[model samples]
Target: MAGEGFRSALEQADDRIVAGRAMDGDVAAFAVLVRRYTPMMRAYTQRMLNASADVDDIVQETFVTAWQRFSELDDPGKVKSWLMRIVSRKAVDRIRALRPVLDVDDIEQEAPAHSAPARVVEARAGIEALGAALQELPAAQRECWVLREMGGYSYEEIAEELEISVSTARGLLARARKFMIVRMEAWR
Candidate 1:
């Protein structure tokens, strides 16, 4: 327990120091950043993209870009958001590159679960329904929602990343929320 606590503390150390070391060519520091943010990046990219195969590639590319441009990071404290922005951009690029295809992976049959609680089953169903509803949103609105809600980016950041005005980002998010609410109502 003590060792786990120590490891957690190390991982939670100041991002600025770690990022500074990474900028100065410390491979281990960069590894720390990767370990800290990879899970969130993977999750964000997975949500942004419909296809599962390309999520890993997009996340890997995000880190690669961050590494190449380490010196350009103005604020190391914002590394988490910076990494998320990179993942968002990469996921968008991948989506644009691939012709839109209806992803049936989300609709595929799931393996049987033994002795799962009713709440767990219901929660899983809700999540699946939400994912299906997200898939139905327009690409622009979907990206806005993922960046704002899942990526935890602000409206200004979303606007800058998506190359639109702040009001547009707000509108997109609003529409997405409304659509999701309506779609999810059927699940209740």
Candidate 2:
């Protein structure tokens, strides 16, 4: 009845309106956003993290962080990417804690369920090749690569996280991309 209408209204609102309501402490509006985004956020975290990482925990943390920082969202229209940035930062923190022992094998888990056996095998090979190429990169370059490519962070954000200048971040990412392009040519 009335609840259904309210729910529909929330669902119909654009991101700016929803985000503004959430920022103004509308729990129902925030809940609508959570419902809309949790699945995609979960999937993104799973891809960004290792199998051992508790993706549910990371996703939950993302929402909590988002709620706490809702007031800081300068562009409400970008809330989706903003949520993803939180997920990226949280997932990276988990990765650092689990690093030096990461299992790249979980990459195979992201493959399509209906893929042919040959596709699976090829995907496995590609993952190994990418992992090896990543290993060959300088540590700084690799960090920049993951933060930019996988985390979807801007150069400025990546630079701030790495405590480097924007120029350095751009250089590192550029070199990393160039190296990956060269090393991964076999797959293409």
Candidate 3:
């Protein structure tokens, strides 16, 4: 338990150190930041985007933008949040630009690698149900819910990204959650 805590602390310290160095124009430090955050950014982007938007391309564009604006980041200790915000923005931009919704089949099916086949099947069914429920939401509500729930963003962050008021973000999230719960209840 102690070792796990120590390792987590070390990772946090390293993230802060690398972010500061990157802001100071250290290419090597910036590379370390990229390696550390790419997977997380990619995953976040994937969840934020519909099937029409290419997750890989959006994540790459996010990193490029981050490189250009590293010095603009206010808090080095919050590099993970910063990176996620970039991904969220990039994904939103793509969604707006493309204006295409993902077909139901395009939703990714995920299962725990070592799970039993029945468990995998059950997980996939749940994912499908959730995806269907999300699709029922208005775009704005869906975006707000995904950012707050899946991406772990605060209300202020969601409002800023979506260019809406904090109260609006909150309302949208509430409505979205209510709708999802009602829809999922029928599935059970």
Candidate 4:
């Protein structure tokens, strides 16, 4: 009975309406919201985390948090962005958990096992350099940079997702870019 009319009606409803109903404790409405956002959330997580980062786990954890805290959403119309923000947070947490503790001097990047070309070696080095530089950025700056550069989000969209002002988002992105450029240049 819960899904009979609720799911059908929710299929055509806007995100905010579905969010409102979900906030009101309608499981069917929440399921609709989950279905609507899961694909995007998964893609976003993939961009944020690597193969070992458990993209599915992050996405699932995001939906679980969203379900538990849907009522805390200040703007129902921004449900998509809110879900994205949660995914980002979860992905970062997973990254932190997965980050292995290694001594700087002891770390030697081994060559690709399959006798890859020199270009592959250079590309791998560049990626490793970029990753190390990113680790140096402040967390917010890293978030803005990833959202803008990798996630293909506009400044305004990044601001909305990070809950920062546009100017602040721009500043963070700029700092991240500057730091990365210098770090990569050193690598080169």
Each prediction's TM-score versus the true structure: 0.48, 0.52, 0.45, 0.51
- In candidate 4, which residue ranges exceed 4 Å CA deviation? 1-5, 103-188
Best by TM-score: 2
What's the residue-level lDDT of 164 in candidate 3?
A: 99
**Which tens-of-lDDT digit does each residue in 1-188 have in candidate 3?**
99678545545666778789788987767777777888888778777774445998988888899999987899898988998988898888888887867898988977757597987888889999999889989999999999999999999999999999999999999999999889899567
lDDT of each: 0.87, 0.91, 0.85, 0.87
Tens-digit per-residue lDDT, 1-188, candidate 2: 99999889999999999998899999999998999899999988888874545899999999999999998899888999999999999999998887677578755565566497888888999989999999999999999999998899999999899999999999999999999999999899
lDDT of candidate 1 over 37-147, digit per residue (tens): 888888888888865799888889999999999888999888888888889988988888886667787678655564358767888888898889999999999999899
| Whole-model alpha-carbon lDDT for candidate 2 | 0.91
List runs of model 1 lying over 4 Å from the truth. 1-10, 100-188
Regions of model 2 farther than 4 Å from truth: 100-188
Candidate 3's C-alpha runs over 4 A off are 1-13, 51-53, 100-188
lDDT of 1 at 120: 78
lDDT score of model 3?
Answer: 0.85
Error of 4 at 181 (Å): 35
